[model samples]
Target chain A: MIRAERVTMKFGRVAAVNGVSFEVAPGESVALWGSNGAGKTTLVRCLLGILRARGRIEVGGCDARRRGKALRSLVGYVPQELAFHDDTRLGSAMSFFAGIRRVPVSRARELLDQVELDGHERKRVRDLSGGMKQRLALAVALLADPPLIVLDEPTSNLDAAGRAAVMKSLVALKQRGKTILFASHRPDEVASLADRVLVLKRGRLIEDTRPSLLWPSEAGVLTLRLFVDAERESDAAGVLRGAGHLVNLNGHGLCVAVPGDRKAEPIEVLHRSDIRVRDFQVLADYQPDWSRS
Target chain B: MSSGAVQTAVPLPRPCSAARNVISFARREVRDAVSSRWFVLCTGAFAVLAVGVSFMSLAGSGSSGFAGFGRTTAGLLNMIMLIVPLMALAAGAGSIAGERERGTLLYLLAQPVSRLELLLGKYLGLGIALTGSLCIGFGLSAGVLAAKAGGADAAAMLMLVAFTCLLAWVMLSVGMVVSVVSRKVAVATGVGLFVWLALVFVSDLGLMAGAIVFKLRVQELFIVAMLNPLQAFKMGVIVQMNASLDVLGPAGMYASQTYGRTLPWMLVGVLLAWGVLSLAAAGVLFQRKKSI
Candidate 1:
């Protein structure tokens, strides 16, 4: 678990993170959604006790600023910048981080496997591709199996499939009861993976909402295109409304507003109503303004 | 899990983890220094250059020549003055800057280790690595002297080596100061080399000019020499090697007046001050540096 209370970090005249407060409960996966320079990475750094801030921060119940060592042992951080010592083999780098974390050295191999980078542990960091390097970094961060993991832009450099793979591993981590706070600008990743999202803009928290509760106005709204035989438009609308749907007759066909989850049920009702339903498509229910303005 | 077991599993006390973390950082720094190719190459080059210079001096002076001891000592001392600073600079010029460039410094500092401990560990690791290089270079030089000069005085050679080590420590401290102050490795390296040049060449020239222009007495010259570690080291080794070399003037009064007395202690104080100041500067800078 991680908590921040009124945390504010400044670089001279510029505020990198300003009066932001949030928490990631144990076993919960929270996504930090923001555009570039929105202070997502800065907030993550402040929580890790790497950056000096003006307010309180606690990691796994330890005061991050005062008890940095204890807090560090309980948390793993994967930085956005994937810079590594190129000369060291991946295994040696993992072992070295493991040694510093005072964790079991065997955890290196286990984590390497967990990140699906088993055979390439002996390769130098420079030899790894962008996705492979990100995985290796994830493996290093997981070496201690810390209860909380913070990832900044974990999929920013990956292709679509690579991003999906990394997201899958992160989802697996959440399933294993590890609290995760992942920051990214990718909406699809947040939509697909995050249980709860925190939107930030210009170092300020603008919105925080659960994905299930997003787009309330559009949640139960569906657009339907019905191809009814020449004389059946009135009959189709009557039948659709009788079936508990909001129907509107259009020039092309009958458009109906059905609850997003029950849009398919209306088609079944139309089939029994003697109305010809030629084609239909279900629109995804998502609000573009879920991110901060 | 049982209630008692869950209560007992509350992670170990904070102090234990903090101590372990500091030790871990120190160990990692030591490993990095040892494994660095730049460190290996610079130290190796210093050793080879020392040995080569020593043997060349011996051959030039002839094996059985009476002046072979003096030539070998001077050659070794000169090499130490030049090579030790270069080696120390190369070892430490990027200690903090290189980590920052790699973006790993923030990662390490993010842990519970205090800035003081981080700076201390890095300085200690670099000191150890430079000391190892000094030993190798000085050892090879002494071996060459013994082999080419039909076996020189072991005690005298050791004393010179000890003095050389002291000078190397001073260089290490200077390099650390530059490293912590500069944000880029290139800048740190440039500043370190500049300081080294000033100490080895310009300082002596400036002191000589000051003494000559002012027509100062030998006592003033002695004080100026004492202020410069490189000069003091050169004079100390010269005096240690030949008692009748007339290091001062025709009367050899300055040599007798300065050598084997409070001068060594004063130089020791200078070296200690440099070490403490440089390390303190590094600690302060680290404490203030933004984690980025």
Candidate 2:
């Protein structure tokens, strides 16, 4: 479904993407796991034929350079920075894209309905919350019903519910056998969605493996179980929450959501608040050693 | 629900939706211009100015006791020069740059349409809106004149309308160039205004100052005046009206002697060239620009 050979994008003296090459077969879902400036967006833009790069790219049998319109027609793209004018109606905006994509205008209505945005067609696009806008972007991407779907930072801007909503839409797309390549920093999204994970660092593809193997080593976020003094459990939960972790306080244990590479910070946070951790354990069901250096 | 990152067999969409895509983009530009009140204000201002200037010219020339077509057109031409280009620039200058700031530009570009198609669509839409407003504004004022006194030259009035619309097209091209080059709407608009002032007022003022200071020859003055489209438009009007050379100072008189009756046609040719070249230049510049 997609092929990129030695794609390199240089900006001034620095190469944003340096000699990156990969291919995705039909019916495959690949997740590009990278931090900021890892060249994910640059690489994707090169694939879309929107940026100048030194390489060859082919999507759905269309050459990215000579057949850009055809190549773009074969892929649905969702950008990271999403925007819609306050006065632009959802229906109008969608139909506008439908026309551009050479699909029937009715496709807009169908996709919006598919995304569960049926009743809000008349609502202004900018009036939508973060989740609705993201969904709308997905719908816009899905307009062409392209064989391949590409998204940059799919769930980064969404809340928990928004992320769930986006993933559900992706699941539907996947079940239809559409190849998907998405750049994300969220481990949960990757574990749930990606068949393969491509880890990138400093513009190079450092690792390529199945999600199972990559889960423990390069997960985008981490989950830890903090065992603090019972008297200070509520205070500990509060402290974790105040320190920017999502805390789930239950009888079993206090599970605090910590991002990858920052799992040690939660334990340190509790210690600073005069709380003793009797014994803390990692609660990640898929991989206990995830985020361990 | 299926787990995550699965491929689906979605139906493929057809390709090359260029015609519909261009029309949709143009319609979007029109909607944006109208909704933002730029269209309404320009139309309203032209209407008011047209009526006021026509009546003042009619009353000022009381000896005729009637508003002649030629007299009203002469007054309207001066106003059109001041209004049409400026209004067109205002409508056009913020088009791409303003949308870029609002993130609409990149969103539109992300679609399947080509870059040239997008720019051409915008130019068509903005040109139509500006041209339509000019007709209505001038038409209303013309209607008032015909109703009050009558006997205006129908042919001459129609020619003025045509020329005015063409003039708007010329300025729209200039604005599109500004919009493409500027990163911000304010900068585009500011540059557009500067262009208007330089071409309409400052250029003429500068020429006059140079003429006085250097005591330049008539041939030198005519050559310099020919470089400006505004000067060409004015010369075309003068030639059409068969105005006397005395009022035109040395340049017009010298140009008349050098070119004879073919001078107005040459000036009109220059105006047409201005519109075509500006649009072509805009297309070339915009095609090379990288969208966000």
Candidate 3:
């Protein structure tokens, strides 16, 4: 259902997504694996016609640029970031999206149910937890019952439970014959849902093979640094350590091991300690330097 | 699978499909606008000034007839001119930029809707919301005037309300363009205030300065007034309310003398051109824009 030939995205002197090409047949699930700046999001944006690029991309047998409306209408999309109005209630959002997609409101409710958001229609979107929001976004993607669904880092900010909920929904979508295409850095999500894996590095496709061929040989580790006040840094580190997270002090800030897919945990720990975190970033493929030595 | 021929999208109702998408998005904007305290405050400001001035005019004029309505509308028009444009700017400045920052724009764009439809619908929604609030404010006061002085009394009031809505629309369109270009709501709002200042203070001051420096005649001043929607709105109101045309300097005298009874219609055309062109430009620009 998807074909891309030599897709390249350039911004002035920098090429964000260089020449890359791949395809996904109808009912096939393909996961794009990449590091943070691997052009995964840019590639997905190109497929969705959000960005202009030099390439031939045909989704649902229509050129992405020429028939963007038809191409978009045929694909369900969940962006990497949380995408919903804070003040809007879930039911109203579903209805609004239904009107935009020209679908029935009942279908929205059904999709919400499929994503395990059955009884939370009246809740304001902002009131939902991280995982619930991810699930809600999934339901929105499934609203039109499109033949294909494209997700960009579907569970990038979610906790383990949220990630599980999104994975469950994807599995169910796969069983129902919907072609799935996603870009993600999480090996676990790839192992769970992707039939094929395409690895990207520096905007180039490095490997195009089955997920098993890539092998989960190296267990991924997450390294995070939280910038806090000197007075609160020791206290914040203790909170994370109390929660079973390994903590180390570096020149820049307190570095912590955020186990598994729970990236928000360290921030929550710091919040409980009344430490204001100024900034933070995640390194997904990190092999803790302590272990390296 | 021979299912390559399967149609993934159901045949949507064409022709009015763009309109439908616009309306759908518009309704959301209107809903959000009305729910916010900002819109409520705007409507309140309009109502308080309109109703309070109506009563004040009646008391001050001591003539509960056409003259009383004239004084009331004259007072209210200045307030509407100040309030409505600011409200429209506030409404529109955050409309697109805020949504883009929130990532909601991407989700909305990923659907079947076209960029033009989305932009138009958002502007329409915001325009309608601001217009509706003005209507409520004007209607409440106008209703009182109509009841006390009779049907003929409120006619001018309704006309003023219509012109004010048009002015609001013009500002909303300008604000939409700002929102489209800005990456964050903070920047959009800053740009919006700057625009309001340019229209309200800079343009009016510039016109007067030009009139003095260039020693512009009545006709030249009239053309300059037509160039600014806010100036057009004020002149249009002053002419309709039978307030002294001399207050507008030579421009008003030239408009009344040259345009005859069609000056109101000409002002309407100016407002429409301002509203339609900016709105259309915003839609076209967004179509070619990188939404991400």
Which 10 successive residues of model 2 chain B have the least lDDT summed?
B1-10
Order of all candidates by DockQ, from best down to worst? 2, 3, 1
> Chain B, TM-score, each prediction?
0.84, 0.88, 0.89
Give Cα-based local distance difference scores for all models. Answer: 0.71, 0.78, 0.79
Native contacts retained per candidate? 0.29, 0.49, 0.38
lDDT tens digits, residue span A147-243, model 2: 8899988777777777877888787777777799999766678877898988777888888888766544354656688787788888898887787
lDDT of 2 at A34: 70
Off by over 4 Å in 2: A217-222, A225-293, B1-11, B63-67, B212-216, B242-246
How good is the docking of model 1, as DockQ?
A: 0.15
Clashing pairs in 3: none
Clash-forming residue pairs, model 1:
A69-B112
Docking category of candidate 2: acceptable
Instruction: Write the residue-wise lDDT of candidate 2 on B1-292 in tens digits.
Output: 2232223233666666677767888998777667767788988999999988777777667533233556777788888889888987876788878777897776666667777788888988998888788888878877767765564666667777877787788888889888888889899999999999999999999999989899978889887887788887777766766665556787887888889988877887888888788878878878766545
Please identify which of the two predictions, 1 or 3, would achieve the higher TM-score against the true structure.
3
What lDDT tens digits, residue by residue, belong to model 3 across residues B123-222? Answer: 8888888989989988888776766666335557767877888899899999998888889999999999999988888998998899899998879888
Q: Mind giving the per-residue lDDT tens digits that candidate 1 earns over A23-88?
A: 888998898877678999899888888887999999888897787767877777777756777777
Write model 1 residue lDDT over B123-183, tens digit each, in one string: 6777767777778877887777767777767788778767777777667767777777777
